[model samples]
Target chain A: MLSVMETSRTHDDREREAALQQLQDIERAQAATWLDHPATPWWWAPYFAVWSGALVLSVGYLPGWGSALGNLALVAASGFLIGYHRRHRGTWPTGDIPRELHRPLWMLLVGAGVVMAAATAIGFLVSVWVSAVVTDVLAGLLVWRYERDYARAAERARRRLP
Target chain B: MSAPPEAGHEAAPAPLADLDPVLTAPKRLAFMAVLASSASTDFSFLRRHLGVSDSDLSKQASALESAGYLTVTKDGRGRGGTTTFKITKEGRRAFERHRDTLRALLG
Candidate 1:
């Protein structure tokens, strides 16, 4: 002869207890997969620095006859390193090499490089300057947008947990 | 003449024994999954990834935090409000035990 309120209260308590227990079980399963590797923040620091330096050099050096060839070389080197990293990690999405290479940011950068090279070949330093300015603005915007998206994704992950 | 004795009927099986009660809830499982994948994550990150409201996350996080399974810390300036979380040693051990128990039960 229990009252309805008492019965509901008992049910709620049991539910929370059960949920907590399940949480523990999941944590254990995940630990088996997660704890093997020690955290390393600097694992890819050298690679990132090298790539960043090359990008800065390619962008900062202005439009000139020789600069186009140098820029092309930079692009080739960057592409090779990116491909090598992806292959070594075995993390490449399933697709042909060309299709797998389709990163929007990378493509935009390459396009800018090509335009700068064209302006240099035609002896239009002014055009090259304009292109550089446009590319810089676009790159900044893209970076800001990506950071926002990453933050949002991280927040969503947190909310999924009890 | 009287009828012959009737055969016995077996009772129905329980629903998968409540799925270990501790490992069956969705949000808790998701939390464990995220923690298992990342070295450490923060409260904001988890909340955004899980798509739960702030209050809801706080409540669930408190339960795990109290159980010694997670460590939570508040940092950053007043406006920024950053809180970080990491799994503790006891938390890892508990998780391992739970996994073994589930495997045994399933078998």
Candidate 2:
């Protein structure tokens, strides 16, 4: 009897079909829930906006000490974000680390810093403010790029859903 | 992953034998679905995510363990230890086969 039952559905094919559909519905809902909930609860947009705004505003109008303090704070925040991400990388259901994520953004920041440092050491060569403007522009571009990259990754993940 | 059923399964409903009983239960299936997608997950998080009571979750989880579908590790010592559950290779294969067979049945 068990073998026969295993080989075929019970006589009520309609009822069996209904049960199958309900199971599929439940399964899909479960998949969708897990899909949306990544291990790392990344809330990037607002944090990026607030910090970047403060960074640029401080560089533009804050007193020298105030600007320096603001920059220091921003650097600390960046460090904290990296640390938090690393903490979750291996331990949680976040899966593999996206090795390519924000690569361009990090490189841009590094390149901008290197160029700015060289410009300042040359003794009033082009203009002091020019270097700051260039770096600030690069940072703004990074903010934009990060958002775009995150969106792309999210869409790619959605395709794997049930 | 186990090879999906050959083309004939599309016309006839997949045999019940094609399904993995351990993966068929709603809660257990949900558990495997979550674990299959990750390296590991905290016990508490998985239970909450499955929306099952603690004892119920523990029972289903233990059944999976006994079936060689998953492994449960109790972190630290005995009581009050944090538990972490990870799906084994067999579990991953079983889940993929079950999922594919399920799709075939639905068709």
Candidate 3:
């Protein structure tokens, strides 16, 4: 009788462990979704491009009222993109960015900074218009790289799930 | 008489007993896991991720809704519609408690 009771308890423990493991797998899968997300691959590029353009206008690449119009365009475009993403993705990721994203995000910041610095130095020697175009390229290249890295990380996580 | 507890002998209630019963179902637990990270999630996304039929997902979601653990918003009807779920403060608290209990038990 005592042995039977022990065996039952052991079985219960095994079941509990399995459930906990499933819970963990579910959490990981969700984390992957959060990392890669639906709008990640294509949505960011246009937004970043507009942002880069806005930055150029703000920094005197374009003179007078053109800068104000650029700013207005940025705001409107951002609003539309955000709304579209919220509808398409069907979720708002309110949590802190995942740890796996740290590398990509850091790379984005560093790459943008380097591009800005180079553009500034070259602007002195070359034309400001050329430097502004370089900034635009910065947004495109950095977004592409970030998406690639994010997809890779998300895939690795999916593979790890049972 | 019962024997004395030995070095390897166990004498404790099951750890699962401490968990919130509302989250015991794997699908429901997984559902909450997804919703907990995001502010809101749609029904189709939950259905695909949980690998459950629409009816099954609906049942489980209704249960959570009934428990006041989540709120469901339905827009329109038929194919063009959307159903979205958002976790409540109560749900988040319960999920956190359940996670803490699981960790304590596993440790």
Candidate 4:
């Protein structure tokens, strides 16, 4: 009698565990779907390119008033971008950055930093505006690369699901 | 699951009786789990993710909505119409409880 009860309990446990696993997979698959895009549209790279370049130019070369105005413009553009992303995607990602995206996101930040450092170095040799343009181009390329990496990483995560 | 359980959940598991009844159904549980990860999800997207027919998804969604676990918003009509679902605060709390119960059961 005791063994029979234990066996039944174990069976129930297994069934419950399986159900739990399925629910978890559902959550993860949804997360993967969200991560697949994560607010990045085709023009995301170009928008950041112009925005970052303008920011650099404003801080690096503009007078006080011009820099303030540039900051205002940047804020407005950012707000617009957020609205556009939410409207088009019909979802707002709101959670810790998924582990799958961590590496690519870190690489993007590091690449941006390296490019900015290089741009600053070049500014000393060439014109500041020229450095801004160069930074703009490089930033766009880095963002594009990051987008591809994000897509690949998200795809790998989706493949592993279930 | 895309990830494993974190290590700190190794304590004595809770009893199965603690599970949320509203989340007992597989499709409903999965639906809430998905919603817990996003601010709002569209109806079509939920249907695709849940692999349910439009009517079936609507039925499940309506059940949850009636339970005050989620809110549904509709825009436009017919072909151009869009419906979106957002989990309510109560829903999130319930899901957390259900998930914790599941984790306990696993342990």
Candidate 5:
């Protein structure tokens, strides 16, 4: 690496300015790489689409207990697989984000929970297809919406910091 | 001495005194930047990303580790082993301060 920033205390304004400029360039390059880098691979998108679709389809086509069992199996299997994969990989990311950025995500979870609760309540009083529309289509849309909105909010908050 | 100005990390140019020399080095700074973004990063990832030699990366990592800025862990045995690096809380704080200080200077 360049020792361009290793100037001494005797350095003048011009040299200091150059170092600062270089630092800015470095920061910009790093930021670009950081933002563009995906935590998951491209295949993850299709995985999500297929899995969610299957969950929704199951809720609509299967008997109530069958749907419940399928959903339960999916959740349990997903949890187990993720844990197993990470454990074996050893270098899997901890996926930590600052607690402040988590505020909106937590709220989003609460909102999703409320929607899910409403869907289950509706299921008790209505047909599986009706509940599936709420739980599947609307809930999926809500997640996507919150993901975009909350991510923007988090970026804003980070920028606003001193 | 007069007290330092209190507000605006963006508008006011920060003094060089505020910058941590530990993270000011190019390689170490880059390593810390990556660490700050990720939960943990492998030594190889950092090496490949920075395009630095193993010894060169090791020297910088050693400095940062000694300074309590990053932790270096050996994940396995012998040649099969992988080295992992994670930033300490203090290291993260210093990295953030260094970034803000640089930005302030840029302005």
Candidate 6:
């Protein structure tokens, strides 16, 4: 004779078809969630690009002697922004660093500050054109490096997500 | 018709009649649905997308683990530990069964 539990198990088998239908409904709902956030990637690129371009153009337009000093300031600002954005996104690449090995991000800020000061002093004591060229080169390098780093970080984040 | 003496005794509790929907609660179901559609997901990725608390996420994950629905692995190091989760074959079957049951009920 079949027990009550055994009978219920048989009923469960009969219900299997219904279970599959519900799963499809759930899957459709989940897919809709992705569509809702579709504009996000398209918006981020143009916004960031405009801000970066403005920063470069502002410093690049300075007079011969002032150009280098302006470029150095731009570099420092760009580095700070890059660090800030990384920290904001919670994607800072310090995950591998041990707690004891951790150093304040202030170190990066300090290094940038020193570069700016050196550029300013050189502009005052030597030729402005020479200072401008050096500062612009340094600024351009910092910005380029940060852009690459940020792109790599974004890619890693994408790969980690479902 | 007269019932037997054994029939007069208390009947066994029904094997969870509403198991389909209950098993696939919105968040857990959503988690599995996402995993089913994707290759895998990491801890922070799921956390940010699902907008659930760490403890809540852990609890839901534990429930799914007990059901043999997912495999969760912890990789990387320190406070920034990386956790990866993937749906299991048994989980896929359970999800399908749950959906089938729901469809039958609706019909």
Best by DockQ: 3
> What DockQ does every candidate get?
0.08, 0.18, 0.49, 0.38, 0.19, 0.11
Per-model TM-score, in order, reads 0.37, 0.51, 0.82, 0.78, 0.54, 0.39
Query: Between candidates 1 and 5, which one is better according to lDDT?
Result: 5
Candidate 1 stretches with Cα past 4 Å from truth are A1-162, B1-25
CAPRI level of candidate 3: medium
Better of 5 and 6 by lDDT: 5
Alpha-carbon shift of residue A39 in model 2 (angstroms):
10
Give each candidate's fraction of reference contacts reproduced. Answer: 0.12, 0.23, 0.45, 0.50, 0.23, 0.22
| True-structure RMSD for candidate 5 | 9.0
lDDT for predicted candidate 5 compared with the true structure: 0.65
Q: Is candidate 3 or candidate 4 better by lDDT?
A: 4
List ranges where model 4 is wrong by over 4 Å. Answer: A2-10, A36-41, A58-66, A119-126, B1-13, B74-82
lDDT, candidate 5, A4-100, per-residue tens: 4334222545646766765754553244223323233334334443455456557666788998998997798679767644433333434344444
What are the runs in model 2 whose C-alpha is more than 4 Å off? A1-91, A94-162, B1-11, B77-80
**Could you tell which candidate, 3 or 6, scores higher by DockQ?**
3
- Estimate, for each residue in B6-75, the C-alpha lDDT of model 4 and write its tens digit: 4533334567678888888888987887788788878766777778999999999989998899999998
| DockQ, prediction 6 | 0.11
Model 4, A78-136: lDDT tens digits are: 99998877667666767555677788989998998899898888788887898889989
Which CAPRI level is candidate 2? incorrect
Off by over 4 Å in 3: A35-47, A62-66, A96-99, A116-127, B1-8, B11-15, B75-78
Tens digit per residue, CA lDDT, model 6, B7-38? 43444333346465436576787676656654
Place model 5 in a CAPRI quality band: incorrect
Task: Give candidate 5 misplaced runs (Cα > 4 Å).
Answer: A1-13, A29-43, A57-73, A76-162, B1-15, B78-81
The candidates, ranked best first by lDDT, are 4, 3, 5, 2, 6, 1
| Displacement of the residue A137 alpha carbon in candidate 1, Å | 20
**DockQ result, candidate 5:** 0.19
Tens-digit lDDT string for candidate 2 (A1-162) = 666664655553664674476466445434432344444454554565456556655665579999899889889998998666433442344333333334544665675565446545431565445544554454455556655665566455456433
Candidate 5: residue A42 lDDT (0-100): 39
